[model samples]
Target chain A: MNDTPHIQLKGVKKRFGSKLVLDGVDLTIRRGESVVIIGGSGTGKSVTLKCVLGILRADEGSIHVAGEDVTRASGSKRDAYLRKFGMLFQGGALFDSLSIWENVAFGLIQGRGLPRKQARETAIEKLAMVGLSADIANLSPAELSGGMQKRVGLARAIAANPEILFFDEPTTGLDPIMADVINKLIASTVRDLGVTAVSITHDMVSARRISSRIAMLYKGRIIWDGPTDSIDNSGNPYVDQFIRGSAEGPIRMEVRS
Target chain B: MSANENILSSNWNIFAAIGRVVLAFLAGTGRLAVFAGIAISHIVRPPIYWQLVLHQMLRIGYFSLPVVGLTAFFTGAVLCLQIYIGGNRYGAEAFVPQIVVLGITRELGPVIAGLMMAGRVSAAIAAEIGTMRVTEQIDALTTLATNPFKYLVVPRIVAAVVTLPILVAVADSIGVFGGYIVGTRSLGFNGAVYINNTMNFVTAGDVRSGLIKASVFGFIIALMGCYSGFHSKGGAQGVGAATTQAVVSASILILAANYLMTSFFFSE
Candidate 1:
């Protein structure tokens, strides 16, 4: 892994009208490092990811990928820059109108303009990497089970062999066994591809399994960031409360009638 | 405050909520315009999604042919019946073919077909994309280094703009044929005269104008659907609302734009 960071964000601030989502956030992920962000719902973890992807523009801040300032980049330069990253959305986000292989090859065929036959072969290979069979590639996403869908999503994410990968709540809706399987797949794939990964998840087990380092987000800022081994001993009360899944801690759930 | 004052305050609150909705809607429109501009800039750039565009054209345009064809045909038939009844009162029954041909070619065919497409295609686009939004698929698209506008919006818009005129042209011709069928079979008119009158009286400009309207309406319909869908919120309720709003907004805009185009084309 390179000593230089692959993805970096500094003084990143974003707000939706009066509601501040990410407040002057700053973070960095080293090349080939797998970092998982842990946070409660609506704590701006997803917002942070969106800001980095340029899906939601930051109100103020700088986002850099591979040392290039992406904050002001536009058109083809930005698009070309984006080709380095891959993402697995929380819901798998597969197009229902497309078959599994087609979804996997969507970027390869559409974004990269690879021929259909070549893209399909590449898609099948990626699907196989994610433990999905070639037969499954012909089916629609709606036909797959939740776990299978996530696997297909993973396949799609890695289709182009991007240098950076982002997984948002990868294990949110899966059963424990399925979540563990996904976690292991993510870990092995990250290692095999030597790709830098940034993931956001509420599942402590998932965070523990897939990350080289973990960051806990609270009140729109990262309260704790360190190696995965140091997470349990970080002595941060917020991290403690979150990892323990305790109700009676520094984090309070909002209750409404 | 009295009871009447309380009622007035509640009404004011409603207005305030409405104002918020309006502001949000305007903001969404601005964002969509920006998104569209960005997508257009991406069109000629590398990493183009030609396959996706082709697939979308097949889906949005080719798949829409049957519906557009049927709508134009029925509209033409009904128009003929109405003109025949109205013209007969003044002993102008012979004018039915010309009137039907002109109306279908100049106004009714494109507008009505556009409205139908707005309801079908716009709602479908909105629902499909709105569901994707609620599910975080659009964000995923971004992470995949895929421009959602190119992957989602551009193709639909391109397909609609390219195909709707063709559909309108087909509808226009089929509609005129429908009038012929009705004028000859049901209305007891001279078939040859009706066909000749339709061919002669309906100038090429009228047909061209309707096709132009179709192209514009296609853009409006697809854009509204994509814009609403891309900005949907509140999960399922939001998706439903986006779909409804897309259809309604597309329909209204089609009519309004049609009036503007008509005035532009035929103004003295």
Candidate 2:
């Protein structure tokens, strides 16, 4: 395998007014690698992902996708860059107006100009990949359970066969069993497609299962990064505290009585 | 602090507050202008969604028939009655048909239909798009490599600009019919004379002007709706605010544009 990084972010910074969200972050993911960013609820994990997608522009530094500077790409260049990405938002974010299959086929039809019939076939194929059947294709997204919706979201994410897939808190609202199912699906999809995957989640089980490598974000930067097998013995107090889910640690979460 | 200093500081504070509001308004106007420019630019680009445009036309134009029709009809009836009653004092009651037709075609028909559509269409557009925004569906479109403006705003704008004129034509005719019903039935005039007087007195310019105003009103209504919804944040409360703002802003703009267009059209 040629060892070029599929994505690289160096000294990336983002802020909303006076709130410093992403403070000089740096990370890299090699092609075909599945990397999960583990972080607490307000640690700018999503902001980092958004900056890479150009949904939210970074205030400083650089982001490169396949050796092309994407941080400042605008208009057609930005659109072309975005075409390579498929994001599964936290809430599924399925187009509620469209049926399940239509939602899956959306990027294919709208973005790629595929024929409706071919797009429908591709949608069904993707849905099947996530363990959903063809019977549910015509139903609206609201008709699905949380787990099923996540499956549908996964199907949609992989619909266009994007080279890079992003999952924003893929397992946040699911039951443990459902979260595990989604984690497996994500893992299988990434492996089967041989695509680069970056996911943000607070779920440790999901992180360990879906990712080849894991990075823990704290204080607007990646505090720990290593192979998933080494996470337990990484000896970083913050990562240890987070994975252990103990209240007593160097990290103090705000709580009010 | 001394009383003089206190008074001076208080005066400065008041001016500062007023200045802030003025600046905010100007800033908002500038943002709206830029958004409008972006929307217009996307409108001329290729890959137009004709099906979506037709869908919007059905929703905004075709479905609005009943409300716009009834409003125009009633306004014409009332104008006929009022003009006749008021004109009777000056022995000018015979001028009812001419005046009612003039009023309906030149002003009442388009304005009433525009305001009614603003109330109906603007709120619907804002609520739908605002919900989409809150749910991150618009963001999803961007990630999917689809331009939300091209998919959402352009179709609605074009549909409104096209449909509003057709709707105004229907309203103008119904309004004229309403005036005829009142003029001949209750006012006790020969139907033929009423029709002939209206036909002779009403110029094509009057109808054309009203249609022009309706098209402009349509553009305003859809643009405000799309703009407000596109910027909505937070959640249900935010969508609610956007809906209300769309209606209010569209209605005001329609009236203001009416004034401006009427002045330019009839300046001579």
Give lDDT tens digits, candidate 1, residues B35-114: 67875666656555566667777877788888888888889999999988898899998889889988998998899889
Cα RMSD for predicted model 1: 3.0
- Model 2 error, position B147 (Å): 0.7
Q: Candidate 2: where is the Cα deviation over 4 Å?
A: A254-257
**Per-model RMSD to reference:** 3.0, 1.7
Model 2 error, position B256 (Å):
1.3
Instruction: Please provide, for model 2 over A88-181, each residue's C-alpha lDDT reduced to its tens digit, 9 standing for 90 to 100.
Output: 9888999998999999999999998999999999999999999999999999999999999988988998999899999999988899888888
Kindly state the number of residue pairs that clash in model 1: 1
With a 3 Å backbone cut-off (N, CA, C), the pairs that clash in candidate 2 are: none
- For residues A1-257, could you state the per-residue lDDT of candidate 1 as single tens digits? 36667989998888997999888888998998999999999999989988887888888989989988988776678788889988898889988878999999988876787999999999999999999889887899989999999999999999998999999999999999999999999999999999999999999999999999998888888889999999989999989989889998888888775
Q: How does model 1 fare in lDDT?
A: 0.88
